[model samples]
Target chain A: MNELHIPTMAQMAAEGKAPEILFWVGCAGSFDERAQKITRSICKILQHVGLSYAVLGTEESCTGDPAKRAGNEFLFQMQALTNIEVLNAYAVKKIVTGCPHCFNTLKNEYPQLGGNYEVIHHTELIQQLIDEGKLKTEDNESFKGKRITYHDACYLGRGNNVYEAPRNALQVLDAELVEMKRCRSNGLCCGAGGAQMFKEAEPGKKEINIERIEDAIEAKAQIVASACPFCMTMLRDGVKIKEKEQEIQVLDIAEITARANGL
Target chain B: MIAQLVFLIILAAAVFLFSKNTGKIRRNILLGKDADRSDQPALRWKTMAKVALGQSKMGKRPVAAIMHLFIYVGFVIINIEVLEITIDGLFGSHRVFSRPLGSLYGLLIGGFEILALLVLVSCVVFLSRRNLLKLKRFQGPEMKEWPRSDANYILFIEILLMTAFLTMNAADYKLQALHFGHYIKAGSFPVSALIAPLLPSNASSLVMIERGCWWFHIIGILAFLNYLPYSKHFHILLAFPNTYYSKLSPKGQFSNMASVTNEVKAMVDPSFVPAATEPGRFGAKDATDLTWKNLMDAYTCTECGRCTSVCPANNTGKLLSPRKIMMDTRDRITEIGNNLDKQGKDFQDNKTLLDDYISREELWACTTCNACTEACPVNIDPLNIITEMRRFIVMEESQAPPSLNNMFSNVENNGAPWKYSNADRMNWAESD
Candidate 1:
């Protein structure tokens, strides 16, 4: 077993040391059993690349994405202001988020609340790591020739114009990358946006996640690659509901890159 | 002299009525909440050019774009002849520019004839799309009897207008060749020349067909101008202004609630006191609660259903049709505007854009995926209005779905949407 160290921002601050990047392990990444794997994968990649990064740990809170999207602006600003105070106290300058929701909120919505930071989605960081040539899975053939289709997370894709980074991260692997019928700017939501993750879809014939997963099935993708935590949850449930659990697998980009690189 | 006087009265009445209706539309649109879309003039201009004038977004569907261009370009260019027609009508003259421009007049009329033919063919194709073939985008819950008939009615009017223009030119061409009185050879007729052989050879009969079509064509144009305020075809004019004022931010970034921010600041900081502002409505319940841009978006909707067709919720049998949202908004405002006209400006109607027209179920069905916004060729944003209504539901009415209420409470209490304690946030790191 490999031993690894994860530092909290408080620990770094107490040690009078500053990490280069703050890894925003969003609420789903922290609590969801499946998303925890993605959180670890991102940490492993940061460690392997010898980049200095720290987590906010207990001091961190939800970025108020679900609250905001659910139209509880009061609750949203409350959570946002709390998180901003924490981030500003640490004088955090840069961040990489494991989820698109956190990435979008920290990057776009935070500035108006005075929580300005250079934020990137984990897939974007992975793309950059690949470009810098510090991260490699050149010899890893686990995903070679597998029909891997990438799901564009709404927050990462049309929301922030990040259609390329996730695909580019997948490109470094030796896999057959296919596209669902709706991809990029035309990508379908996984029924989790606007706080739908916590609610039953309003009287619809079929769930949105089921509809999105069918697109993956139609594309003949064995492994559906995703970048956002909420997307991963919805897609995993979708595959389970379709009884395609045996035939199809849902994995986040970080998990894929981490596994392929033996991290 | 009597004919000219009648024409002058008809033109004045059409212009006056059109202005009055459009002025009411402007007032209704202005009744919406203010929004700041005027900061970036250059960017807005470029967007208007690309989305409206250039029709860049329409390029997604090549067949529709090409056909639409025929009508759009032909309509703009052929209207040059409307000016000539007006001058001729007022002065009681035939081919008013013929003697002054000479050969240029012939070239212009030839081009107008060619354009009129294309517009005719295009309207036929557009009509077929609605009635014959029945493209799925054109049919939906919002597309009721009137809207369906209204679409065909516009196309039929266009066809009739083009037919009159060409047939009138055809009869005039025959009279010119026969050297009839005041029908001197002037402009060329490339398309109408072909129809000339089909006309009756009798000079008096030719004069009647020519004169009748002349009156019909001009009157039809005027009627169509007045109809612009009532029909979805008003997009031809509103699309320009709508695109210019569209939300330019990234689709994911919803506008932060400045009002909420002030209240939150007062709560967080003991020293800070919020300004004594009028208690802002949480979100939009009525059309007037929405921003002017959102109201204009309602008017600018072409009823194309591109947004609804691409909507994931709509695609999967959900009640959330973004096109319906826009239409309902337009209908609501128009209803309010009418009531205001009848019962004074302060009259309050119990109806609202939210539940009265758009249901709560339809509102919740939206994932805020922005598929509708992306799909709109004219840059209409159905999502902004969706979020605004959602804000009204959650913040003002406290009527978010039970599931969302639980999530909100969890977020408020535990610092996350789920019921996990903040103390355990770093548990994932314990694996190694």
Candidate 2:
């Protein structure tokens, strides 16, 4: 682990300085053990590019995506309004999130309730940094010619039509990008969306993630790349189910970018 | 003269029955809660044109699309000939248009014959696809008895009606050849010409066959018209109106709850005290709670299984069938309407759409992916209905799954979906 000193938005505001973007560390990034690595990877990429960023830290709350999706509209509104009040108090204008669910809620759903901000998914932010020549990647032989297939998170792909950003980020790694039969607009879900991640799956012939992983295997990719934390969890579980964990690795786009940059 | 009197009596009875059924369907659909989608008249018209008239989304499955187009176009065009039939049956006239229109009537009848053949062929293929080939989408638990039998019954009716039409034309051609009483030599029947050879050449028998077939054709058309309100075949009439009022907003944008949003606004504004109002039940627990557009969508469902075929959950062997959701909604509304008609509107059935029709497992299996909505040619949003019912379960009954219960409690105490407090949010950013 590397020591990383990250300042809070409150600290930045008190110092009469404002970070360019607020990193919304969603619940998965903040508390889930595996998703925490993805959060650190995103932080490393931001630091590597010399981007000014600050976290909401203790002041941040959930964007109420799960509650909304789970049908508790009242709870969702309460959660959304509390977060909106804190963000509005700090005059936060731009936000970047590692989770597509949070990104989607903040970008699409928050506007109606007066919580408007320029929300960008981490993969999209990374793609922007690469395009701007701020983030550089060497021809790393570690991932060179490695067959990788990018799984489109529903919220990032069909939910928002963000099909290009994550793929563009992976293009920088010099990996052979193989596409699953159901990719982009036709992508299948990882079975974790719409609050399914919080509940046991209903009885079915096969889990949705398993079916999705079969698509990855059919694509013959050794690495499955995902842009959303929920997708990463589902894909990883699928790989474990097939007992191919040793052969196949499920990783976030940020983790790949961080690894390639040797940050 | 007495024969014509009997025909008028039969026609009146059929019309009365058809109108009564139509009225009941209209009342049942209006039982749903109101949702104001009346804005954007130009957009609504364009949507109706593109979706219902143009059949734009049908192109997703090209083979089925073409087959459906043949049936759809044939159904619309052939009904014009029915208008003439209605006039003739009511006035006791024979070939009324042929006398004035002459050769144009020949061309028109010829065109109708061709369309009738096409509709016959399309219906046969559709029937084989449903019954013989047994497409997976058509055989699911949701399509159990009534749906499956209802589909075959409509196809059977169409086959009978088309047969009766061609038979009537063939028998009339024979009678005209014999120069029988009141049988004028007019209106070409190209397709039916082949069938004329199969019939007996006797004048008396030909007259009986022609009269019988004519009566059957007209009466069957009236029966089918009335049956439309009771069957999923109602899409023949409701598709236009349903598509006309389709949601113009982007699919991903969920509508905000005005009640909850106002409360949130009050929380932020210091001087704004929220009105002390009783909290109403959230989301839809039954068909009545749904919007009128949702009810229209139910009636507009063609039972085409396109939504179910493309549903990722159903494809992955999950129980969430979007087609079933719409069918269930329609069935529930009909039941409620019947209850209201039999007993007063105040009658309670002690049953609800939530448990009696749709199961919690089916509702929870949905991923809210919008694939069903995208695949629907009529723009029915099953995801919207699913979300509404889920809202009822969680908000009104507090019956969310245990895992969701954990997440809810965590959100309440920690302001997030995890058990950890916000104090630990920055821990992930800390270095070892």
Best-fitting candidate, scored by lDDT: 1
User: What is chain B's TM-score across the candidates, in the order shown?
Assistant: 0.98, 0.94
Model 1, range B289-383, lDDT digits (tens) per residue?
Answer: 89888989999988999899889889889898999999999999999999999999788888889889999999888888888988899999999
Candidate 2 structure quality by residue, lDDT tens digits, A1-263: 35676889999999999899999989898888889999999888887777899999888888888889889888888888888888998889999999999998999888887899999999999999999998878637779999999999888887888899999999888889999998886788898888988888898898889999999999999999999888889999999999999888999999898888877
Candidate 2 residue lDDT tens string, B1-432:
676777789889988998899889899899987788999999999999999999999997887898889889988998888888877877888888898898899999999898888889989998999989998878888788888999999999999999999999999999988889999998888999999999999998898899899999988988888888889899988889999899886566677777666666676676776656445667889999888888888988988887887676788888889999999999999999999989997999998989999999999998877778877998888888999899989988999998999999989899878788777777887643
* Cα-lDDT of candidate 2: 0.87
Candidate 2 residue-wise lDDT at B38:
90
Per-candidate TM vs. native?
A: 0.98, 0.90
True contacts kept of each: 0.83, 0.69
Cα lDDT of all candidates, in order?
A: 0.92, 0.87
DockQ of all predictions against the true structure, Cα-based: 0.82, 0.60
**Pairs clashing within candidate 2:** none
- What is the iRMS for every candidate structure? 0.9, 1.5
